[model samples]
Target: MSTERDRDPAGRARNARPRDALGRPLPYGAVGEERAPEGVVRPPDRALAEAQELLDAGRPFHAHEVLEDAWKSAPESERQLWRGLAQLAVGLTHAARGNSRGAATLLERGAGNIAPYAAEPPHGIGVAALRTWARGLASAAAAGRALDLRPPRLRA
Candidate 1:
């Protein structure tokens, strides 16, 4: 039997199922962390603060969702930055989930994506430091070493 997915008010397919702290979807009607509404156009400052708060709370997956929204709605010039941040969050999620391979790949990729901004980072983002942090974690994870997944400061 085919199961129908949840839909938003506009009929767009949305996952209304509750999610765990790591963003894993639980069964319908299961109590889970409250998810933020999607597709809203949050200003950069708001997005950053929200994402940072989530990250600090050990909810990297939730942070990724916020960053993904920013990336999708960002201007061309800033799109990659948001994308990188989202990737970093995903990397953290993988780390917490004990997927070292996934964590390594995403951490490296995300660091590379954000490295370009090192020369002249915008929004006061700590791109250089963040890239260094991710690279170090990625290297350790790749070497079969378990590393602590601490939340990096998003701003300089």
Candidate 2:
């Protein structure tokens, strides 16, 4: 089975389905599909800034895309940081879409992945705070409460 990474950013395969700005595949007859290009990993500062902007703008799904690029391009030592951030963004996206179970699962998993970075995150990202925030979100979702929590800032 082809994974999401196997698909083109434009979702243009022989059986291309449309996608949203977040790169989410739309249903077969869905309209208004956007062609959001996949993100490229830039310098750490720039990538974090861009991803934070997207998160603050209520676009966690887009943030996930940005972070995914970072995860793909980061050094081995920092891969977990970027991947965790991406997962956190995806968790938020699930929450916003009213998938509480998925939100909880991803949030907890993201927090676990981010735990090691809590002491000294790259670019001064508040990894500890982010993990705490993720935990809170997970708890809320587990309790069946849909929250509209603000995204955490990347800087300390």
Candidate 3:
């Protein structure tokens, strides 16, 4: 039984292995493929608003998808900002999934990536505050405590 991963981009069978939700590879018969979500990148303002909405809805995975689209389509200079936001969303997703170690690592990495943009982040995202929040979350996760903190808003 050939799976999607076993097939190349053109759909030809290969040695590719399928993966599960947590990204662990599955047996040959198991089904799953890593595909980007649909939709073009919206303008920065609209994208931030939409991503924030998803995050607030406790759908950090979806938020990460949205932010990833923005990251892929952003100008070279702004890529880091979008990437950082996406990472943060993924951190939230990991936290929601009860993966404390993964959550803490992603949160800290996201915080570091976003720090340089703190003083003047696009869309007024309060990067500094968000970084502090991420740090707190990381610390809590490292201590084996899960926090249910409110999602940060993207201001302006």
Candidate 4:
């Protein structure tokens, strides 16, 4: 069986941790170009971009679907990272629907899962803020705050 990680844009790394925009520890490795396992192929960047765009547009559920498709195509080892992002997307979807607690849980898992990868995340996203955001999600859950999955919304 071929895994998608083999075809990741970042290529196959032996236990490499993915990072965020700023450079923090996430739960997975960067997606890159490498030979896929037989019939499997790498997830397209277009899907990831679409998901991100959805998040930007306040459409987390739609974003989740976009990323979910990519995630499923990703390798097993990398799946957690993708799943984490997907869950975070779902959490954000819930948050948009006014479900803070649900959002908190999913976001928390997403952040946790992303931790290992954050150590060496891919390009674009901010690593420090991502980690901080993840931590903030857990804290918000603890304090029962209406957690917002939206990234860097507090900034102006």
Best by TM-score: 1
Cα displacement (angstroms), candidate 4, residue 14, comes to 37
Clashes of each: 0, 0, 0, 33
lDDT for each residue of candidate 1 in 1-156, tens digit (9 for 90 to 100):
224887777898977778999999887778999776788789998999999999999999999999999999999998999999999999999989888999999999999889889999988899999999999989988998979888989998
Candidate 2 weakest ten by summed lDDT: 32-41
lDDT of candidate 4 over 1-156, digit per residue (tens)? 233343345565442344332223355545532211222333556656666666676666656666676678877766776777777677666566666677678878877776677666653434446556766875776577766555432111
lDDT by residue (tens digit), candidate 3, 95-134: 8778899899999998898888987887777788889888
Error of 4 at 42 (Å): 7.5
TM-score of each: 0.94, 0.81, 0.77, 0.61
Looking at candidate 3, the ten consecutive residues that score lowest on lDDT are 15-24
lDDT of 2: 0.82
Q: Which window of 10 residues has the lowest lDDT sum in candidate 1? A: 1-10
Off by over 4 Å in 3: 1-39
Question: Candidate 1, which segments miss by more than 4 Å at Cα?
Answer: 1-3
Looking at model 3, the pairs that clash are none
Q: Please state the error at residue 31 of candidate 2 in Å.
A: 6.2
